[model samples]
Target: MLSRSTGRTRHVLTISTLGLTVALALSAALGGPAAQGRAPAAADAGWSSASPFAAAGSELSGTVTVPARRGRDTVVKLWLSNARLTSVPDACRSTVTVRERASSVSADGRALTCLVRSTGSRRTISLDALVDGEPGQQVDVTVMVDGRATPLGARLVTPGVPVPQPDLRLLSSPDFLNADVGDLVRGPGFWRPGRTANSTNADYRRALDTILDDWRAERPESVLVAGDLVEGWWGTEVDRSGNFGPDRTLAQRKAALRRAAATYYPQWKERFAERGLEVHAAMGDHEFGDNPWRAEKRRLAPLFEKEFTKRFGRRADGSPRYADRPRGSKHELSAYAWRPRPDVQVLTLNVFDATAGGMRIRLDRPQLRWVERVLREARQDGVRWVVAQGHTPIVGPVRSHGSSKLTYEGGAHSPLWRLFKRYGVDLYLSGEVHDVTAVHRDGILQVSHGGLFAFGLTNYLLVDVYEDRMELDLRDYATHWRDAPDGTRLWETRPQGMPKHLQVSPTPFTIGTAVVDGEGHLLDRSGILEQYTG
Candidate 1:
């Protein structure tokens, strides 16, 4: 029987750049005839160009005149342009105008910006304004061509607080278990004996395509990858004449791993570059190896440093290789923070590159020190949102104890968790166990979605962050899993026994959950669930 969630579900399809172009053109054409009118005297002033002009394909550009400060009636034109796209097509001319209206105030009160676009022939177009306003401020905008009477109106208004970000979509299936079947020579992990339908996997290729499509559609400022790109273990191989790896050189194994990575990773890389999306990845266990104990990590760290720096690094210099984060940086691994927009700060951590292992848990003192300093500086800088992502999760359900659960600070609980509590980390993103889970401790949120290469898996998660809330969406590939007991569908039903600060809400054909709290306690639940075929 098909899962109930798959019966009537809404899938977030990947819409390409071409799709956006069509939408823009259609919207402008449909609105042109309805807006046929002209404004007063400003028409006689002759044609005047807007202050800022966007290059082609730029999603936003244009100018409007507004009072310099609150309470002033005089308005001067302030033009702003975004140089992102190559050029704006002539077809976009009809949808332009000047904007005037009080919109939402920024975290810091500043000049209000409204949404306005260009219209055909009428250079002096009035756009809608939705920025915040202190009393007594006003501006005048005359969007006019050389001689034609341009239509003008102040329709822009402050946008309502954006809804919490939506959850990412995930698609899953029984067939996902077969993902690595024919690619025995690939993947850095040993293969287990199981039916193709029993393996856990994700449709990475499809997900990559969807992400690119979404980026073109939304034009997000930056994309963040939490970690875990490779399996990090020897790939499944046919046992030949009882031969084992005691004789195989590490160098030979490394070479084989690289070949597999090269074969499987090209498509993902091309998709990222083509979209012009700024891509950031946090090194995961798979990128190096699974169960990377502290000692093993110490040894593997140099090897990976060489591999990435010499092989897969990218920078503004157009070099396809890794560059040191900075001179004299103590982070022997690639861990740093970046801000794509003024409102958001992303901190990526290479948690695996420290001194600890299955028999011992230790946070390399230097790395720990660096983390504290970075967090302190970021908070002091008045950064509103901080998102931390890495490969190993500080807390989650794991099956066999290997590395993360082994030892800790002075043989106590892992130090990473304590750090999270102390620094007020907002969200934690990780992948290791091939499962989807949302665990919240106090107000801190940890969203985990791994299992991309289980087999015939087709699933990915969607996350959305809104001003007042955060939303999570888990999408399955072709079908949904249903409750077998009563054959009843589950949708948007809150989970049971959640702490006051933590909450889970299920949605139609999907599981939508939100943990509401500015601060709360997150208990540790470290046992992995037994595998079952339902």
Candidate 2:
């Protein structure tokens, strides 16, 4: 049910007459960089998304972010470099536009090119651009997409440079089992159900806004949703009297879902849009009626797929964004991949493609085989990193029925896990159990980002990518603004588990970091990142 990426393979470099030492060892307990002896996960093939690192010289570039703060003018620094060029390359000047209009830009190559270190990997490219806008502005910068000009999308401006200055950035979370987040009428569970039962839309918005506020400097590129983006699957909406409500037919439920999409889909879409990230969602159990297989699936499947298509299907120009991706038809909007940058490939899985969790879940042969095909193509495309995302975890730490673990109903050791290892997937982002846990096994990392609907340990993952390494920062949304600037303060909680009786821990929010070396071939240090509290 989840999905999300890395960045460009370019760095700014100048023949550094003054070469200084930089600490390659970021974490304390990490040893020297692991050897790149393992054969490439798969042999490289020609790619559609051009890899600038492939040749000695190409337009090696990073993102240029401009804050869309209407009516005001701001400046942004775009770093660039060409390992093959001693001076400006042929396409050195990339046009800068705002709201699709051309903006004046002046390149400064004197100080920048000189400071770029001699080491090919240690070099950087620098460019400067100015942005002017009126108040309340929301516009885009144009970028070439498949010979077509497309908007670079909006960027939420930030103050200073954030660590792990990656080419592409993303946020991941799952399990949003609610419709009108503000009106998820609480059931007769342990706590009250009504309007204010769990987290209100306002609560999540406010908290998430606070977190983004800190990063208002520069928001991540997009979000990878690990399914369960909605609540109240067909039969789960029964009343206290056990009635399935008046709208019970497959046709009736479809209408209700369409109505819900009108209210709920925009809730998340707008939030993500404002934060400057397009949502690439997954198909969680909730999307499939949560309950076990029934004859109704025949009728319900098409309608459910229709709802997702309506909500997230097309672009403003009527382009079928969802349909354009992988074979997402059966579960439409459920399986797809987007390469934000040539070096990074983002793949989304339909956990409900073949089987819904039984008592435990399986990725049926179709999905498993389909995943392998995608990974193989990624390798053929010269992609250096692959991040496979789904809803249920192949390896999870929490104890929940939906979890795929040794004891959970969602059991493990399926063909999917082996594919992950065989393909050298750097990270498998998942979420079923709400607790934030990152585990490394068989040379692969599985970090279940905390869920959006849960108040307990609600968290998100921020990834920064380099040519040989990627950093996964598990950020706490609740304590992000509450913690001391250093994040040294401790916090605790005792919320009832999703099952209502399970006792939960009171662990304080902390920033967790996991590093992957040589295109995810090795997990450098599977531990927490203590330096950053903000």
Which candidate wins on TM-score?
A: 2
Stretch of 10 with least lDDT, candidate 1:
491-500
For residues 362-420, could you state the per-residue lDDT of candidate 1 as single tens digits? 33556666667767666788755556776555554432211243212331145666666
What lDDT is reached at residue 521 by model 1?
A: 35
lDDT of 1 at 147: 23
- Candidate 2 residue lDDT tens string, 1-534: 000112323332211111211212111111112224532111111112332122221222332222223333322212211111112211122111111111211112211111111232322333221212222332122222112222122322222222233667766756643233422332212223331234243444555454444433336676777777765354323322111223556555555555545555666676667766667777666666554546555356556666676666666575668432545345435577778788788888766543243323555455566778878888888888888788777764543433332221233466777777888788887766655556667777776654533333345566766766775655443232232254331110112212211112222122344567774444322223221121
Cα RMSD to the true fold for all candidates: 19.3, 18.2
lDDT of 2: 0.44
What value does the lDDT take at residue 503 in candidate 1? 12
The estimated TM-scores of all candidates read 0.47, 0.54
